[model samples]
Target: MARKKHTEMSFLDHLEELRWLLIRSTIAIIIVAGACYFIDDYIFNTIIFGPKDPNFITYRFFCGVTHFFGVDDTYACATEFKFIIQNTEVGGQFSIYLWMLVTAGFILGFPYILWEFWRFISPALYEKERKKAALFIIVSSILFFIGVLFGYFVVVPLSINFFATFQASSDIVNQFTIDSYISMIKTSLIASGLVFEMPIIIYFLTKLGLVTPVFLRKYRRAAIVIILILAAIVTPPDIPSQIIVSIPMLILYEASIIISALVVKKQEQNG
Candidate 1:
């Protein structure tokens, strides 16, 4: 293919560039996915099932905290968790392997994917803007991983414990489908990771003059309501769990407001 001149590239040229970027990003994901496939036994047995065990670190820590508080009546003193996952289809295991690998690919290749996105957009931006955006891919990638960990270790375990132990009818047993269990884990991690990037998202929106600090502040009460709703949705229906989930998100909202304000100030100076 003939390369377009640097100063004469058309919209189609840009689209062609984007095509290569995606191809490279997909290659990176496959490399990481292959590694994940090899270590999937450890990943599935350890990290994925870690929360289902009573000896999970979170449970132990919660037990210790309850002891330190001299509260003896809580369910945190449990010795073993009482839930089992059952695969209901003949090809379920094979399907799960494929799904897990793809998810791992997306997670591990996130930084490269972000780089591709940046590359596709950077040519249209000013040098100053490009410099600012260069670090965005890195920062956002880190925040996403951190958020995934937080969700997997903190929120997912808590939810599993609560729902696993809660009894609705004396005759009903809790034998959860493997697909359902895995879906919950995947959803929690991915959702929280994206939620944790609010400040970064807000910064870019501010740069584009799309969101303002005043707009965030003016809807403070409304934001609070929405945060609470999200908290209830992602977390178990307990006051402490809801509060724990909400605090970080609420903090993100405040940080977004600050970031937006700074971006606005910088824009004013430049204008």
Candidate 2:
């Protein structure tokens, strides 16, 4: 069935379309999550718990870097964490397992989710703009996955390492709940992925005349402060870790300015 023109579609018609979009996206997620059940062991033991291991690749890489730089007695060289993860609630682990399945499903099913979203909005876009759906989905998904990897490899490890080692006193032992651990991991991955969509976001804002290159430039200093604050919130309270997170976001902000400029230039040409 052909979609009605935006002007022809009634408000209920738009709502009906949105309803189907959500339904389809949810089904996609559920299917992907169901497939994940078969590999639950690998998901839990290898991927989810991997960061806690001293020999995790991220830790090993950092350790190697510190070793090459002749750093002595750094936490990077530690063989074990002082904390143990505990599940106080009887159903805590089960609850975490279900939540992780949904998270993994959403991550893996992101492209399809984007497709569904595009389908919802494309009816309102010009034909030329609608034609760019594939490009938009591809680029957005790539950026999102890269951010997720960065969060996993950089943010999560640094956070876990810092919390594991940090102590106010020798008498206070550190014990983390499974729920808290999973929450940190989920927040880091999802937040980073969303942050990486700044360019895509700016492009649309530009198209809508809500943002401009000059505006982005004028606020660059403020954006930097906000980015640093976000980095500090997600990463460990250390300068190096914050720097590591900030660099990519700073780059993305610059890219957003460029994108906004191009969009405005195109609009001017059309006019």
Strongest candidate by lDDT:
2
- Would you list the clashing residue pairs of candidate 1? none
**lDDT tens string, model 2, 34-122?**
99999999989998899999889988998999989989757876789889999999999899999999999999999999999998888
Give every collision pair in model 2.
none
* lDDT for residue 67 in candidate 1, whole number 0-100: 92
Please report the TM-score between candidate 1 and the true structure: 0.91
TM-score of every prediction relative to native: 0.91, 0.95
The parts of candidate 2 lying over 4 Å away from their true place are: 1-7
| TM-score: model 2 vs. ground truth | 0.95
Best by TM-score: 2
- Candidate 1: worst 10 consecutive residues by lDDT? 1-10
Error of 2 at 107 (Å): 0.5
Q: Rate the local accuracy (lDDT) of all candidates.
A: 0.86, 0.92
